[model samples]
Target: MIEAIEIPTAAGTFDALACGAPGGREVLLLHGFPQSALEWEFQLTALGGGGCHVVAPDQRGYSPGVRPEPVADYRIEELIGDVAAIADALGWQRFDLVGHDWGAYVGWAAAAAMPARIRTLTAVSLPHPAAFLRAMTEDEDQAQRSQYFTLLRKPRVAERVLLADSGAGLRKIFDWKIAEDRIDDYVRRLTEPEALTAALNWYRAMHLSGPTGPVSVPTLYVWSTEDTTVGSTAAMATERYVTGPYRFEMLEEVSHWIPEQAPEELTGHLMRHLLAHRT
Candidate 1:
């Protein structure tokens, strides 16, 4: 059974959903933009069923308690610290890490900043920061793909457009395969007062200035063939940044919503990669 609880960190407290053996080999799951710990419902159930301890937190601005007003509060450094502090609070000196979308970006930073503490990393849907930066500079396609980041950074405009007609604009971004009820749940969370903006600050205050070097820990980077947000250029370029064991799994015909739309397949990939690196 999934337990809903408050997790205290140095930054503040986060509402998290946890399952599995509390003392089993720990795994921390971080969700991405416009999503929450609820998005990992499947992974939490699957991994927890497999005798693993799992905690998925509604991160930073996503959690009402941890929301800070200033956009600067969402910068990469603070984001990294939140993940580290959350792990520390969980009494895990080191634990397996998994993240999707913006959470994947934070995972890359967390692994780089606290390599000794991140036993292994499974970064889904986003590539390493440096590779992404390089692609944005050199690849026209990737730059075009990333244009949405600019739109999302705008203040009142984004809120209105995304919330218009009960989040029709926001709903258009996802594939039709995602259940309508699931979309409704995500939309409701984003429409909460101050929630969407705080989440957007992650894109606005985004700077590639943190521990964004080559990762030295065992890692798995998963990308999708049909992901319109992250192009193949950066996805393939991700190999150069990992100094230790690395595995790249590409899901053909999969969209950006990998975990939600393709849960079973994604879980298999995560379990194989993480189990291989277990201490």
Candidate 2:
């Protein structure tokens, strides 16, 4: 069962969904842009039932209690700090980490900078930041795919377009594979006061392309054949940046929304990775 709870950290109080026995090896899941902890619904069930403790938090701006006003407050460093803060709040000395999309981007950077704090990492959709930066500059296909980043970073305009018509624009961004009720839930949460703007601030705060050290922690980077956001050039280059034990999973025909679309395949990979590396 998914347990909705609050984690009050130095950053602020973040609302979260948790599952599994409290004594099980701890795991924290980070959801990506335009979504919530609810996006991890499937993983919560699978991991929780499979004998692991898992928590997925409504991160940074998504949590009403933790929402900050300035875009500067949402920078990459701040986002990374929140991860540690959350762990501290949960009284977890170290735990496995899983992140998707923007969350994956943050996970890569955090694991690089704070290796001791993260036991293992499962990053979905996005590759290593260093590789991604190289791809954005050198790969025309990746550059083209990232065009939407421009719109999301636009102030006022992004909010107006995305929140208009009960989030028709937001709905358009999601694939048909996602259930309609879940989509509606996302729309309702984002449509709340200052929610959409704060969420978009993550994009405005910093470009995903940046300098990140080689990750030394054991990692599982899952890329999808059909994910238009991250091209194969960056995906292949990712191997160069992970120095420790690494696993690259290529999901055939799956889209960017791996957790929602291929939860079973993802959980299978995740469970094995976690089990193999457990303390």
Clashing pairs for model 1 are none
Give the worst 10-residue stretch by lDDT in candidate 1. Answer: 203-212
lDDT of 1 at 10: 71
Q: State the displacement of the C-alpha of residue 185, model 1, in Å, after optimal TM-score superposition.
A: 0.6
lDDT of 2 by residue, 230-251 (tens): 9999999999999999999999
Q: Write model 1 residue lDDT over 91-179, tens digit each, in one string.
A: 88889999999999999988988899999999999999999999999999999999988789898898888889989988987757588
At residue 161, what lDDT does model 2 achieve? 96
* TM-score of model number 1: 0.97
Per-model C-alpha lDDT, please? Answer: 0.91, 0.92
Per-residue error at 94 for model 1, in Å? 0.8
Candidate 1: misplaced stretches above 4 Å? 208-211
After superposition, the stretches of candidate 2 with alpha carbons farther than 4 Å from their true spots are: 207-210
